[model samples]
Target: MTSAPALEQPVSTAESAEPELPTPVVAPESLSVKFNDVGRAFGGRTVLRNVTMTVNPGEVVAILGASGCGKSTLLRAVGGLDVGFTGELLIGDRAVSRYDERTAVGFQEPRLLPWRSIRRNIELGLPRDLEKSAGKARVDELLDLVGLSDRAHLRPREISGGMAQRASLARALARQPGVLLLDEPFGALDALTRLKMQDLLMDVHASTGTTVLLVTHDVNEAMQLADRILLLGCPDSDPAEGATVKSLVTVPGTRPRNRASQDLARLGSQLYAGLGVDSH
Candidate 1:
């Protein structure tokens, strides 16, 4: 039998160095929220200080790190939940003084009203000018988007955890907020359910293109979801010297990711390294 020629292997040399790959570029604009030398204190205890960073419009920024890293506190400050801080906090070219409906926070829990049906919960974000039919239509559409259209008439207590969270997301979107803040929204769910919710969140982002800022202790979760990961370490020795932006790592992986894949593993390792943690 005649032998076929073997394929030649490329030689590795100093010239090869590291192969450069194209990176996705996002345009820079005025900060959605800018914290300049911002500091916060409470009862002689400081939770954050000199923490500065800009949240871009239509950007998905995930804050990830250990507990007590002040990630949640920073989110609260930007959302105008914490007014004890001193510094500049600009939200879409405007200073944040009072909490505006334009910024909506979706917490770990669904927090839906049991007395009201899923439709009512979703319509809560609509304005008074929205007529009953319009509001109902919006609700029905959101329910369809969340894959819970048939459950619109069901109460919060009647739905599953995943379904409830889907309803919560629909309600949050119904407001048409420019900025959406999520604080470990899937933290309370089981591993499988959490994964499902993560996919759903990504789907929503793909369709709505809403600016999302999520806070989570799970490094892998941050790597899988955020376009940019913002690490906030714990406050320093002095209360005045509070938590700051440890690092901002850009995640350039494709969506609908496989958590077990090597790319995700490398990304998680990088995130851990950003937190000053040694990973195996």
Candidate 2:
């Protein structure tokens, strides 16, 4: 395991007063995903307010918060599922509202069609214009990438929960999307399986360098997988009123992370403090 960077020095009140923050190291030229002081409201409820952030290429960001903090809603916005929010979201210079083939969402549920085998499920995520043979070949590769090659012929119901989830990941990666949105993708698995899945995801991300944003209630999970973590503060009834980013903590650990390293524990402590949770 590699050592983490030195702890960030605290900013003095005077230094903070100057404002004008520095740009992110990996700034996307046109902003792959930008939320410009966005606000979202539902009927009489406000889910998020004054939420601003930029997601660059080849990064994995995690949104962590309480149940009603609008984490899922934020993911929905970027996924192009909710259009009622007041904000601007761009994916590679194009607004998320506009159809773009460069993004895909993977939910907690495998949601694979029982009739379709693992290979076909992944193939479905590929573009229609891809030649059938080429698409099938790509699907085979993804299955192997996710460690599901041997289970390629199995139906969703036939595999273990972890295997099913791995297949779901393959489906998400099949499109070769620049952006991958995940909503609690590993929330349902056993603890050991969840850890294995996280390692698998890290491997996939390392190989593909896809921009990923995942929403989860687990602080440890967020700390383990994210390059940076953002907390969605508690929200009001409106989708866009009171919610805002409570804190943003960058993970300074080395690549191919060792789960037991003290660096991860330190990062996890900071993340927990940001969430107002007491770390054991």
Candidate 3:
């Protein structure tokens, strides 16, 4: 099987060079994810239970919860990485088992190959069927989009962490997947870098109109990035019973939202309370 891109680098790059190509346009309704009564268990120990949610096409949804509340498990289920869950998980009209090319996942790490240049790493995510020349152009376009055009020839070890993560995002987009699954993709960055990445993500989302499913622990991150937030809470305070969707909070207003506004602060407070956190 072809290896998935590493977490430390972005996606893989093209093997040969070609002229630059225009960015591809993705159909707006190509990808929509839905979960129905989904549940998972290990050795009869439930991890997630009766969790149901829907991510509309072109929408950005954030999954927020305390650690070990199965946020990652839920994401994995959507990405087709974890198939042990029960009930239904669908990407568009087909089951996730159908493995549609319109979906891609990004992890916390860039996962770039050390030997490959930045450009090459991003190229790895391109469809294998793309023409060599077209692949090169696509890579160039992504590098520019991620603000790494000048650094394309550099190896992974040569760039900063923020740059690497940006490359990782580009790699995921390289496949031009309509649904982008991100699991704490900016969790490890410095505060400033993390905030910058968030803005960059918003820009990318606006341009591509890709549906996003983000799993994050940062309340502000969710408020800043997601149009809707899913709070998974532990019912009866029992792990064995598993965590389920506690609340779905919708953020009001337009893109480029003001994180410092009272509206977001109020929403953040609610999210924190749901997670059993005291912002006081």
Candidate 4:
């Protein structure tokens, strides 16, 4: 894993302050998320079963698992993007509604409109009720935060892949989401760009303090970004019961954790093991 610079220092108050989005010059509130015996099935086949876990306010939780283990399904359940699940899923004490306003989702694809300017695409996600002037300021703040201010006026096709993803992230932030759900947002990026995106995500998380639920296949990425790692899998390598929580690990240390730390390396090996990959 490539280590990002400035991973050993805490973000200062001024640097970490939330942007003028969400509320005019006010920071958005981070919300808690809960899954109570959540289970999802497509007809007769169960993909996720008994997924019960809580993501605390302002904390980042990363989900990892085998292929077809329902990682994306779990994330979509929280986003209210998929309604086929059983049991209760809540965000900030309210049962999740279809396309809940309290959350925003970022998929593996940037999904930006080809015709719209990057700024325009991001503006599309602003709350409908926000005043015109406030919305502009919010979008401006987001642009600066995501380092897309220079490319704000450019179309999605003009910028690099990383820049497009940043625009996507900014759009998601424009919703002022209390809970941000990401399904492998960086999985499509190349190795170096992905590392850079990981660092950028940490910076954004530090600044916004929004509760984040990230579904990723990379153990190192999880260790780098998540406060806790939530591993889902079918027990004993059997696929009959569906995937459920197999390990919930609390990563040690503070934000901007050292990527080269022995603690993290050891923990990474353990996580890979839990996923049925042996460290040679």
Candidate 5:
């Protein structure tokens, strides 16, 4: 993973006592998500079972678990990508039976088109009916939002993995999705890059207030990003059994949190234990 550049700070002048602050951009109201006893199976083998949860509007929720614990499956259910699942999965007031413009999904891979420039790639996320000029403006705005304005003309191959991931995030938000579904988006990055991505995600979330449902196996990633962490696991050690919610942990404090705080450390220990891992 590439080292993340330090976040730029405002430079003060001798004549000016304070630096100018950018106006806050309030994101539009986001939609809520609801899962009612959701379950999925393949070849008579269950993967998810009786998984029910509610993600309030504008909330950042993380679904976490061990490998094959069905966390990604649950997120796919919300995105209407996994139609094989049973039970009701709702985004806002509508059932998640078809692709809805209100939602957007970002996968573990950047999935960018090498042939297209970064700006053009992001434009792919815009609504088909949007006017050409409007789409261009939207694309430009998103490029700036993700801090890729300078690299707009570059192709995906020309950028670092971290920058490419940032572009992927910009593409997801290009439509101004009410709910963003992420499936281990930062999992491919190294530890340092992952930390940088998490910080960038928080900054974006605060600016847009878009609802986020992130699926990740890293406990620290979930703890650092989510308002609440939903732990999924099977009742038995067998993989044939379906997974369900094992526990729901609410991370204390507000945004721009201290990851190494004692409170978070204690909570992390408990979460580790909940995953059946030895805390020591």
Candidate 6:
């Protein structure tokens, strides 16, 4: 175990102390995600229903809502982490199955194994039958993508919180999943780290082109990261039916968008209102 480098520091191959390694051979790509009339219940109470939307390939879609309104429930359904729901979830045209390989999840916590080196933990994500050389190449690529290439040998307890989160993200990407599901991946970080994580995610998406489904309660985060924001809330007139898509808003700018743009503020205000929050 060793101390981690600053999370904000950029690690480039040109400045590394070690010999340059061959570029990883793993190519990045994405697929579409669709949920058709999906619904879920627990203890005889419905929490999500009638969730219908199609996420185009390589799009970043954010799910925003009040607590317990089923934002995460809907995301889990897509990743096949929770399957006791009604209707269908389609990942790249195939209905989702238990432990679907087409998708990978980056949970709120890093969930890294304490005993394994960061490199080995990422290796855990490779397909069981992937060729030995290919798996190594994929793990190498992921470590670099998440800025953990230099820290590859350290145990989980050795790194800063941000670094651990990066490792977790690399592990998720190691699968080369077409649809990446993120459940508040930055929710646990400090404000500055959260912002950095957001930027890192943006870069990852740009480089990998993986379609992303992110669930978060932060309105501003939704505004900053998503191509479109999906707001979920139970109809005020029909609370008994559980939460559903309340509105789908197309964000007004491009990737690495203007964080201070007034246009984003207007959309944020509207999303706040949708969640029954006072923007003022």
Q: For each candidate, give its TM-score against the true structure.
A: 0.82, 0.83, 0.89, 0.90, 0.89, 0.89
Span of ten consecutive residues with least summed lDDT in model 4:
17-26
Worst 10 residues of 1 by lDDT: 21-30
| Candidate 1 lDDT tens digits, 147-257 | 898998999999899898888888877766677888888988889989888888887776666688999988878878888888887644553556777788788666766
Error of 6 at 220 (Å): 1.4
RMSD of each: 12.4, 11.6, 9.1, 7.3, 7.8, 8.4
Candidate 6: the clashing residue pairs are none
How much is the lDDT of residue 150 in candidate 5?
99
Residues 1-280 of candidate 6 have per-residue lDDT tens digits of: 4866643334477667544443333344578988899999998899998889999998999999999899999988888898899998898888999988989999999999999999999998898889999888888878877888999999999999999999999988888889999999899999999999999888888767789999999988988899999999998888878999999999998988888999998998999999999999
Candidate 6 global lDDT: 0.88
Give the per-residue lDDT of model 4 (tens digit) for 100-200.
Answer: 99999988899999999999999988989999999999999899888899999999999999999989999999988999999999999999999999988
Q: What is the lDDT of residue 105 in candidate 6?
A: 93
lDDT by residue (1-280, candidate 5, tens digit) is 6854553334556687443543223245589999999999988989999988899999999999999888888888788777889998888998886666788899899999999999999988887897999888878877877789999999999999999999999888878888999999999998998998999899889778889999998988888899999999888577567889999989988777787789999999998887889989
Model 2 has an lDDT value of 0.78
Model 4, position 255: C-alpha lDDT score:
72
TM match of model 1 to true structure = 0.82
Q: Write the per-residue lDDT of candidate 2 for residues 1-280, one digit (tens) a residue.
A: 5864544333457747543532121111222678888888888787788889898778899999877788988888887777778978788787876335677788889889899998888887887787988787778778767888888998999999999888888887777777888999999999999999988888777667779998998878887889888888853354345678988778778456677888888877777766668887
Best by lDDT: 4
Deviation (Å) of 264 in candidate 3: 1.0
Clashes of 1: 0
> Pairs clashing in candidate 5?
none
What's the ranking of the predictions by TM-score, best on top? 4, 5, 6, 3, 2, 1
Summing lDDT over every window of 10 consecutive residues in candidate 2, give the lowest-scoring window: 22-31
